[model samples]
Target: MKSGDKVLETAGILVPKVCILGVTITLINKTTEYS
Candidate 1:
């Protein structure tokens, strides 16, 4: 149970970081395409 909880905590922390990074990359790609 404790290991599962830790995994969930790690995922909670990582998901937003991944989401923000993905969004930044996509936006940069779009800007470069337009330029």
Candidate 2:
């Protein structure tokens, strides 16, 4: 149970970063495409 909780905590922290990174990459791609 403790290990599972730790994994979830780590994932919670990382998921937002991953989402932000994905969003940033997508925005950059769109901007470059338009320009």
Candidate 3:
């Protein structure tokens, strides 16, 4: 149970970072395409 909780906590921290990174990359690509 402790290990599962730890994994969930780590994922909770990482998921937002990963999502932000993906959004940034997409925005950069769109900007490049438009320019």
Whose TM-score is greatest here? 1
Clashing pairs in 3: none
Off by over 4 Å in 1: none
Tens-place lDDT per residue, model 2, 1-35, is 69999999999999999999999999999999999
Off by over 4 Å in 2: none
* Local lDDT at 23 for model 3: 100
TM-score of each: 0.93, 0.91, 0.92
Give the alpha-carbon lDDT of every model: 0.99, 0.99, 0.99
lDDT of 3 by residue, 1-35 (tens): 69999999999999999999999999999999999
How far is 12's C-alpha from truth in model 1 (Å)?
0.3
Report clashes for each candidate as comma-separated counts. Answer: 0, 0, 0
* Native-referenced Cα lDDT, model 1: 0.99
Error of 3 at 26 (Å): 0.3
**Whole-model lDDT, candidate 3?**
0.99
Q: Where does the lowest 10-residue lDDT sum fall in candidate 3?
A: 1-10
